[model samples]
Target: MRIMMLKGFLVAALLLGTSLSHAKPLVLSSLKPLTLIAQEIAGTAADVDTLLPESASHHDYPLKVSDYSRLQKADLFVWIGPELESFLQKPVANLPATKILTAYDLPGLFWPDEASVSDDHHHAKDPHLWLDARNAVTVARAITEKLIKLDAPNTDLYRKNLQVFASKMHELDNRLLAQMKPASGVGFAVYHEGFAHFVSHYGLRQLDYITFTPEQKPGAKHMQQLRERLSKDGSCLFLEPYNNLQATRDLAQELHLRIGTLDALGTQSTKTYSQLLEQMATDFLTCLTNVRH
Candidate 1:
């Protein structure tokens, strides 16, 4: 009877240990684009989620009481660093270095031109690094490295997922280049300079940007530059998700431009990063072709 009871206790302990070992680690990202990248790496081995709502601006996102609890509980938190999500800096500063991964610290990330980077370190560091395909692969690898440290048991799974993500991004890079070729001649205007990486990457023609960042109003000088350019041709005016609707519509009307929405945040329901990139290219082509001179 003693031996049987001891055996039962050992069996129960073993099953509990197994359950603990199989529990998925939660990977929380600051933005949806980063979440998509992380989900690609985490695969089914981990649960990936985003902190910011799809409609919220990264510039000034308010943290709730529950958000702090989530941050405390998350096994790993990923963010693009102070340049983009400045609000998260203080909340995550006290977290153990191991629990947080900043995409800006990741290798091989592309940055904007020196002018675009601006003197204000807090405001401009080309936070839209994910707009480049190459940076996405780098981010995936860094995420995989962090996950391996957190959950070594899933090393092979994370590595395999990273490989798949890299291959898919490579294919996407080529595909976007080809797809954007026809729209190369379509002169366009963006609300801000955030899309520079993507535009330059795929060789898209952007006549000008109204501002350096979304929150700022378009400077008179920049507006003059755009007026000189867009006045000659009817082209697409690509606006970001955060741009004011009435103001943008009025501007588009003033410039005789066709409006197209570019969800740079990837806020729309896209199951995969590939879909996100494809959607961006499609939106560009659709708007550009429709607004030809």
Candidate 2:
């Protein structure tokens, strides 16, 4: 009787251990783009979700009451850091250092030309670093490393996912380069400066930006200057989906220029990170190449 009772307890303990070992880690990312990247690396090893909604802006997102609980419960929290989501600073301060992964610290990031001399209080650093494919590769690797540290049992799977992601990105880079060939010298203007990294990477021309940030409307003097510039050589004007459409439409109509839409947030179709990049490249090509010359 004693031997049988001990055997039953041992079996129960073994079963509990097995279940715990196979449990998936929870990863919380700050935005949709990062969530997509994390999902690529996590595969089936972890559950990943984004804190920000599709319609929200990363620059000034308000943290809801439930967000604090989500952040606290997350095994790993991934974000771009204070340069982009300053609202998260105080809330994430209590989280352990090991629990947070800041993508800004990742190598090969592209900063704006004026970021070096500009004060942080005055000029905001362009937080759209994911626009550059090279930066995305670095970020994906960093995420994989963090996931491995958090969930050792899934290290092999995470590493394998990273390899697949890198391979896919390489193919995307080549495809986008070939597709954007016609847009190389085509002059265009944007409502904001978020596309600098992407435009520079593809060797495309951005004649000028009407506003440095999306939240702020361009003053009359700035609008006039942009109008003058576009009147001379601009083939198209790209407006962000989140920004005020009326202003962009009015400006485009006034300048007699073709209008195109750019969604830097990856809100349109986000089934996968690869899909997001493909859609963005398609939008760029469709707008720039189809412009009325």
* lDDT for position 231 in model 1: 80
lDDT of 1 by residue, 132-176 (tens): 888989989999999998889889999998898899899889978
Q: What is the lDDT for 225 in model 1? A: 68
Show model 1 residue runs off by greater than 4 Å: 1-22, 112-124, 219-221, 291-293
Least lDDT summed over 10 consecutive residues: which range in candidate 2? 113-122
Leading candidate by TM-score: 2
Q: Which stretches of candidate 2 lie over 4 Å from their true place?
A: 1-22, 110-125, 291-293
